[model samples]
Target chain A: MLKYQQIASDIERYIEENALQQGDKLPVLEALMARFEVSKSTITKSLDLLEKKGVVYQVRGSGIFVRRHKRKGYISLLSNQGFKKDLEGFQITSKIIEFDVRKPTQEAADNLNISQEEDVYYVKRVRYINGQTLCLEESYYSKSIITFLNKEIVSESIFDYIREGLGLNVGFSDIYLQAGRLNEEEAGYLGLEKGFPKFYVETLFHLTNGQPFDFSKVTYNFEQSQFFIQANGPL
Target chain B: MLKYQQIASDIERYIEENALQQGDKLPVLEALMARFEVSKSTITKSLDLLEKKGVVYQVRGSGIFVRRHKRKGYISLLSNQGFKKDLEGFQITSKIIEFDVRKPTQEAADNLNISQEEDVYYVKRVRYINGQTLCLEESYYSKSIITFLNKEIVSESIFDYIREGLGLNVGFSDIYLQAGRLNEEEAGYLGLEKGFPKFYVETLFHLTNGQPFDFSKVTYNFEQSQFFIQANGPL
Candidate 1:
């Protein structure tokens, strides 16, 4: 992250920690500069970003004030963080419905940039937030990249396991978000009626080296799920 | 956009224009550098981005080869642009269902940061792509900001009108993406089953000066709408 963005995040944390209300005044620029050990220009840039994100606003000749009391968002569309990390302060758990190594399907092979002869870890999992099922995900991980996996690892964050356990850098993903309806099997798992409309996310994960590592399809619970995004700058 | 990103977009457009296929080789670094009037470093960064996006691959000794041929995406979630601008090639048309001036509702007032007494331009529109209905929308724009509106303007790009005719700089928006079921009235206009599931987008638009201007709710066809996003960098 850039220096200004880091400072902006720190300021957001400070606001949350202090329970700042809307229109609540923040410390002077000089104090913020001292606190963050940054220059005046950097502080100004950070404040500018905060203002742009609708978190805080600056009053001329006055001081920075909280435009919003809380940082309200569920998922940031630009962030690559998994649900465990993305939805912070939430108790997230997963159930491994099926886990096995198998031959890559044609679609999986094409998406992962691997041949059909290659083996892929075919995993079906259900993710729950606070013990309520939120999504059903089916993923195919290339055995070339992720060499080994077990039932235990599949129950937790596979991305974390890929990063920490295997030391492979999880780079970015191309995600396709579509509107979808639940089938009988999906409806049963998500406790929704058949033909209920919801969100579907298809993601292609890549390594930092630009090699495709995994592909996943996820269906989210309709009523309990909402995705939040923010965009700024001139039109 | 940054220099590297601009070059990346140009390269993508070139590939599209020329109909480059997968495994086709692009111009060499020196050739691209000369073509784009940039240096080797910039070309390398551009190519690296393309590689990460699964657009190309670099061979050790030969050249940069196409990893995938197409620039495939429907909508970028982070973009502040409207649907007309975002979907560049498609023919988009809007039918103005209802247009009038009204007192702001409490939710509308809160989202637009306007008072209940404030007058708002209430617009209802059904959008079609290539003559097929896609979405039904309802919007409330602050009269203080918009100043004026008409059925003709409502039938076209309202965002364009706000920018060009009104000479106002639109800043950005915070969007909420949710799963929704259509009501009888909405389904009637959308030509969908009354309880059919679909996608709902709630948007709060702000001006460059940190003032809220418009609040909108849009419902999209489940079968037709898809949103694409990408996130790069480590983990």
Candidate 2:
């Protein structure tokens, strides 16, 4: 592994061993560089990888802190397969679009097990990979479960909020995959021509005991996208 | 349901109940229309829907047939998702840029859990959604499981082949999602600017015994598309 990767792994180990919870502060870059006998550049790279994975964040001058957030889950988990990490070697960037609390739609209520008229926090985002517009993902969560949702939290990963802020153990989930075309609203957001063919992945997360929690759908431009599943052994 | 949908459902049921193997021909269209008391237009729509789903196909005036010699064990199912029905909606087309069988790479072998030297079929496609270069999907399959493959099958859904031809019991799968930037090879296929962003999905399949079977990675042009996942309660 690269020196930076080692630094990242070490930092992660420290976090785990020390039981340093999310949002906890880490040592200054200079201090870490001196202690670990590594250059500041290597440390920066190490931090970048972690931050991109929704692991930590910098506070401008105060120092880097472990991000108390859940990194987004992949659509592959919702299918009968796990994710293959080597597609086009693409890297993803997320932009927090809008976040707020609102009443659940019938569909959202049915999936999340919330009352149809109950208010829920909505987190909407436009995600890009390699600078191309890839998908717009909108997630709804019961306000009762996530009572402190804010723009700052939305700017990060909601998965983090469910796990860190609420101290809920993220568990296994159920998923559905389908293929479809872009709707007018989606096309507009993705900046594609209306009615473009796309792939749809719907995921529902629940506890091990089968309590329904959240639902999300991701539509990929099929004309420019592909799907993969990884499996082991014979049936 | 509409007459076309009814016919489509009936054919789907007939194939399921009678143990009709993959690549098996169905009753003629005239017989179908007569039995269902439907117009040719309705019958055509029914078949078209099935074809769009990769369930069936037509060969010029030679009449329609199920796609023969398809990849088995994995079903390629389709839905409009309330958008247009086919790739035409994207206004872009795809061609098999490359097709062959080769050994799975270290990563690929790790995903499929076979010997690294085992042969796997590889298919590469460049898709255009709405005249814009979208993505290139390069897929790999176990050669033994998928006895044959071709550009025609590549242009259609693989799920149809797996379930209809091979008689494998396909079921739900798991998926992993991420966002990343396009690399050199993907940039070449997408005609995208270097370093553009994209969304990536990696999925793995397993038999009921939790044995891994296949692995795939799909990348999408993030700028022009989005996807969704509609999940259900745990069974």
Best by DockQ: 1
Measured against the true chain A, the candidates' chain A TM-scores are: 0.77, 0.60
Q: How well is candidate 2 docked (DockQ)?
A: 0.04
How far residue B1's Cα lies from its native spot in candidate 1, in Å, is 11
Record all residue pairs in model 1 with backbone atoms less than 3 Å apart, i.e. clashing.
Answer: none
Give the TM-score, chain B only, in order for the candidates: 0.74, 0.59
Docking class of 2: incorrect
Docking class of 1: acceptable
Q: What is the TM-score of chain B in candidate 2?
A: 0.59
Candidate 2 wrongly placed segments (more than 4 Å): A1-235, B1-92, B206-213
DockQ of each: 0.48, 0.04
Model 1 chain B TM at 0.74
Q: What C-alpha RMSD separates each model from the true structure? A: 4.8, 19.3
lDDT of 2 by residue, B46-73 (tens): 8866654445555445566553222221
